[model samples]
Target: MEKQGQRCSGLVLVPCPFQGHINPMLQLGAILHSKGFSITIAHSQFNSPNPSNHPNFTFLPIQDGQTDHDATSTDFISLITALNVNLVFPLQESLAQMIKQEEKKERITCVIYDAIMYKAEEAANHLKLQTIVLVTNSAATRLTHFTYPQLQAEGYIPPKDSMLRDLVPGLHPFRFKDLTILNFPNLEALLQLIATTIKIRTSSAIICNTVDCLEQPFLAQLKKQYQVPIFSMGPFHKIAPPSSSSLLKEDTSCITWLDKQAPKSVIYVSIGSAASIDGRELIETAWGLANSKPHFLWVIRPGSVRGLGWRELLPECFKKAVEERGCIVEWAPQKEVLAHVAVGGFWSHCGWNSILESICEGVPMICQPCFGDQRLNARYVSHVWKVGLELDNELERGEIERAIRRLMASKECEEVRQRATDLKVKVEHSIREGGSSYNSLDDLVNHILSI
Candidate 1:
């Protein structure tokens, strides 16, 4: 252990209280470890049970032994309300003091903090160490969050109740006909977002997981406005090995199965770790996948069943019909699944990590955006990236079936797949040895040393 006392580069990685954030942080941690940094990753006590987190990674559980009210779960509202430093401060302080004890031999040289965990910033400042903020989302998403006030004023956001947002300048001409964030925010939701946006901007330097090519226009604008250094060294897992994707337990079988199918012939469906669907919708989706007659793999969470009673979530008939074509699991090796030759397309929630992964894997998406900036990502995938189609937030089986068929059997799908392949090449180049991301990491390391 490269603890304090020696002159090693001791580092701490603080991810927000969520899986989406945690995923990227882990990848970066792996990279840092490969580059010789001693790493400490803090996990919320809330997520202690998850097996997906790496065992070798140092784990600091926040909110340990707390009730549900104090834990941070998948529910966005519940998490924001339940989590606080009161629940996490002890761990933070202890770790800091431990560092102090070891500073002579190998110093706790710097911090790589999550932008959401602003308290980590204070901890770094108190310790008088250089701190860099990791913004795991895309450049555009960060820019949107940062510029929410302006978007609200321009009427692009706080969108009229009838449709999708249509007014962000220099962005896709989107109209929320797809049941987007237009449900209108409750007062608390509005306030929380505003607070988060303001707090995140306070970081000393920002590290985003995106490349310059993907969102250069927006990234350039943000770089110009901020005084601190902004680096784009992302799609961080472009050629990642499938060590810890969702389907870790079953990835080998899943990929072997995919190999039996014809090339580019199957649809890989996943709605991310946190999304849940009703029984009615599940049945419809099952029927659609079956009707489309495509080889498919659908990741269904154990607790996703509706009516608060999961027994009735899947009927015997639907399951029987789709079993041969469908492979269902709580989480499957999502990255490997996407990269499979049999996986011609993807059905997803448009999560930023998922989007980047799919783009890097060269798989076209069938977007079913659920929340937050997902709608914006869906738009970019469909319009800008030219890699996928939108589910339009409609749960009907006919649309699902038709979309699958078109995605697999049409000229457009082939074109999109080809384009995705090209993008994948570019994404790989950006993260490889001496690639843009490789150099960006160097610059980041040097920046921390200078600070």
Candidate 2:
């Protein structure tokens, strides 16, 4: 009661399965918890996934305080629950009950839903929980999904082989052949993605992990279509305190390494945990960066190493080159790396979190989108946003080499860099006092409080 009295509100966030959704959603929740909202983050226990908790946060297992938290102001969770009908019911039930209980004792003002997690929103609707969908992808990507039906009707999507083809008209065309080659094993998942977009479009509210300035036109278009209100309160990032159990740990060694490099001299490369690449392609990209002779920080998740697993060995030449001017780690403090003075460009898988963070940091991209909507994001970055160059699916060192030089050292690179910096400033302003994102966030708060 006292904690509620101090903060006067609370939140419950449900994140979709997988690292991409969980990581960024967790970051956003933390920021909200800091802003005087008591938070509940629900996760599935089916995967036995770890929340890898932070202070005043939790994992909603069958553990203590899972459905019971009468604690202090700042509380958050990383939902690790499975996305099945059975699991979702109990989780949702628990959420409604928790909020009711909290409301009785104090207050839980809102329910934040993961964009594709339909069950969460259903639960929110049932309980009359003021709902907000958290879109971890670019607003443009949501536009793609929302616009998919139109695209399909207009002959932009065709049935190819066993999968649906995406005939992305302009610079790059997409087909089902690429889906299989890129390992989209689940057609059901694709349909769910499209379905999720339908829900988001008609949704009364949304909380995107983007700033309105970075995607001004799309944000405008989105508002024009569904004026239910939208908020872009991020690339919300912060430095870790020396005093807490951090959400993602940092390695200061990389910062020391970055210091030795010249200003805007290093390339930051991370495919994110969900992106996969073959060993042959990995070697190809390694050699590509080496040949470019640029300083780099490369994150190679063990999960990405397929056939032989992480046990698989890289060629000695690649290792020697990595040692020469590169730092390779399993995971990285991504936000910090982007904020660093040395990072000039990013070689990325074009995940939404990576893209938005890079944009907010004023860094341009060498986009090598792996699969999913990353391909879409890559296309927009190069063609629409004009903030990046594409590293297509050729799997060759020379192509990688050329793209790096063009992005990091050429006149084309400067144009991309300028656009990137301009967008970054714009996004920052949008979340500042009276900015669109800021105002939207406040409006969201008022709506929930009304509820």
Candidate 3:
């Protein structure tokens, strides 16, 4: 075991209390810990880390005064507001306690926080500690968040609810329909979050989980405008393997099921941690999956539907029909499942993590975006990268069946598959030795140490 005194320095990581945010922040922590840093995770009480999974890292669960069940009951904007209001003092107190105990042996050198949890940054600033903002989404999404005020002032937002295509200057191929944040029900609260997130300008540097090749233009513009150094050191999961901080117990059975299927023959469907579909849409999706007639592995989280007891609502006939060909689980070991030989196509919500993982595995996507960065990610997947097909808002069985067949069997899909494979090669190379992501990680480590 590595002794405390032998470690070079201590670092605190504050991830937002969400599965998507927690997983990447913990992966980054594991990567840094491998590089001689003493990893300390100071997380909110809501969605706290399972210490058993990360035994090496010191876990400090800062109280956000939220119960485990709050995740299902509380609305997103309210939860975010409560987190900012409640967690700051506990975070500062935790850092102070750590400093008092370990300062002589291994001082807490810096605090790396999720940019979404801007309150953590405020606390770090108040303590006069060095800080690095870890951005968990795409560079394009980050640009959207940062430039939201400009978009509002320029009269591009509060847009008509119809899907007419328009453009924002400097954000080409990203049309009015692609703007996700503005469509939120709580637009004011989201704008407030954006305003707070931009205070990341006060941090020592910004660490984003995106490679330059995928989002070069946004990264370039961000670098030129911001004084702080922006390090695009990712495809993060590849950099640190077997490093998942999932709040749910992933079903490993999916892997065993995948083993029996033919190569590149299964559609892997997962929407992500926090999207819920209405009753009609859920029924449509069920019919679509059944009509597609391809082998599939789908994740239907317990509360992913609007109605009570969603399991009872899935058509009995449809369930019986697909039982032989489809597998349904609450959650699966996603990275492992994606890399399985049987997964040829992804039916996804296009969360940044899922998108990168699919790209890494050379799997083409059938994009069905729900909210937030997903819309933009789908746009890029279908339009810019040409590695996926985007679904319309109306979830028709025919459209869904057609998309699956095209992605799985059509001649046009071969080109998409090849494009995804080529990008997979590029992604693999980026995280390898002396590549852009590798060099960026090295630079970030040095920058953190210097502070």
Off by over 4 Å in 1: 1-6, 49-56, 69-75, 153-157, 162-165, 174-181, 184-188, 198-202, 239-242, 245-252, 308-311
Candidate 2 lDDT: 0.68
lDDT on C-alpha atoms for all candidate structures: 0.71, 0.68, 0.86
Best by TM-score: 3
Q: How far is candidate 2 from the true structure (C-alpha RMSD, Å)?
A: 6.5
Residue range 1-451, candidate 2, lDDT tens digits: 2343454677777766556777766776776666656666776543233455655665565221323231211111122222434445676678766765664545666777777666677766677666777878777666655655655577444444455344444313434333222344444455455655447533567777776666777777767656676776666553112122223345667777888888899999888866677778787878998999888898887667656654255677777776758887777777778999999999998887788779878999998877777877777678777899887657799999999999889998899999999888887777678887677667766666666
**lDDT by residue (tens digit), candidate 1, 265-298:** 8888888866678878887888899899888988
How do these models rank on TM-score, best leading? 3, 1, 2
| Candidate 3 backbone collisions, by pair | none
* Residue 332 in candidate 2, Cα distance off native in Å: 0.9
Best prediction by lDDT: 3
Superior candidate under TM-score, 1 versus 2: 1
**Per-residue error at 171 for model 2, in Å?**
12
